[model samples]
Target: MAYSYEPHHFEDFSVGQTFESVGRTVTESDFVLHSAFSGDWTELHTNRHYADEEYFGERVAHGPMTFVLATGFVYRCGFLERTVLAFLGMNYMDIPAPVRTNDTVSLDMEVVGKKELSSREDSGLVTIDTEMTNQENETVFSGDMKFLIKRRD
Candidate 1:
């Protein structure tokens, strides 16, 4: 059966649920814009000559950029649309592979935990495991994210 995502409610999420995202190819403009926006002007992420001389042999995107992309992908999946209260935190973040410019990336997530908030009956906490991969199926990033999810009235 095609899994139907539920109405805005804390009970919608369950352990082991996974979501996949549409692909987005990282470009030079994306790399530059993020570098400028975040003030992360690292040579590896911004300078081709420096990056080419380094171990990875080419310019790579910032890790934070990938993080933003993954989060945006989750939103794009419509999993938490109008249902999220606030971002809690993240843990176990890892960049397993290089995120080079021009590499297409996709995100996937799995729900790991859920708990009702003691302070708020209309919301709950959720933990998710996220992985981002490149066109070659190499894992570029992995991490856990926490969110405060709102329930319907």
Candidate 2:
């Protein structure tokens, strides 16, 4: 059954319940704009000559750029629209691989933990295991994100 978009109470998420988001392809324009916006002039992100010799044969996307993309994908999945009160923070983030141009990246998430906020009865904390994978099914990014989720009475 499709998960409803209604506000999911703190009890809605199970420790292993997982959800997935639609995929988005990385385009040349994504790289160009990201590079310019963040001023990440690293050779791996720009400068083709440096990348061709030092790393992958061609320019690669910035690691942080991929991070942002993953976050956006998760939002598109449902959490943000359904139950999110606010984005608390993320922890143990790692980008173990590069995301190259034309790669279709998708988002997946699992509810890793849940905790009632003693100070807030209207909401609670949900810890999610978030991952971003490329078209080749290689994991490019992984991390834990905590969200303030509304409680349903």
Candidate 3:
């Protein structure tokens, strides 16, 4: 069984294991807050009228915003809580579809790799293949995330 609400150690992970995160809905306020703090005035994310004439036909959430939100949703799953030592990196991020406002999204996370570090005996590395899909099951974001996780010694 998956540990959705409990902490998971490096030993708890396996190469083929997968987990699904709870869904989160994007909103206009999400865009506004992101813009207010980031000071980005990109029309594709802020101006609906301008975005309506663009390729996606409406405002799309900022690329970074989608990534950040997806990360937060994964964290809310609590599987890594108190067990992660650090975030190593994220690789090959792709926004295949627009993350529109009011779109509900969830993360499908698969453990791509896991290995103990000889030099750092207290921790190990975990690599995750992630796909963030919207309400219609369209992959809106995709990436591989790596992190340092504590060993169960």
Which candidate ranks first by TM-score, i.e. highest? 3
Which prediction has more favorable lDDT, 2 or 3?
3
Worst 10 residues of 2 by lDDT: 1-10
Instruction: Write one digit per residue (lDDT tens) for candidate 1, span 17-124.
Output: 887788888888888889889999988887888888998898877878988888887777777888998988897889888788789998888999888878998899
Count the clashes in each prediction: 0, 0, 0
Per-residue C-alpha lDDT of model 2 across residues 43-153, encoded as one tens digit per residue: 777777888887578888887898899888777766567678888889789998899989999878888999988999989999999988999999999999899988886
Task: Answer with 2 or 3, whichever has the higher TM-score.
Answer: 3
Q: What are the lDDT scores of the predictions, listed in order?
A: 0.84, 0.84, 0.89
What TM-score do all the candidates reach, one by one?
A: 0.92, 0.87, 0.93
Candidate number with greatest lDDT: 3
Please provide, for model 3 over 1-153, each residue's C-alpha lDDT reduced to its tens digit, 9 standing for 90 to 100. Answer: 453767889888999988888788999999999999889879999998999999999999988898888788778889899999898888678999989999999999999999878889898999999999999999999998898999888
Q: Give the poorly placed runs of model 1, Cα more than 4 Å off.
A: 1-8
> What is the lDDT for 144 in model 3?
89
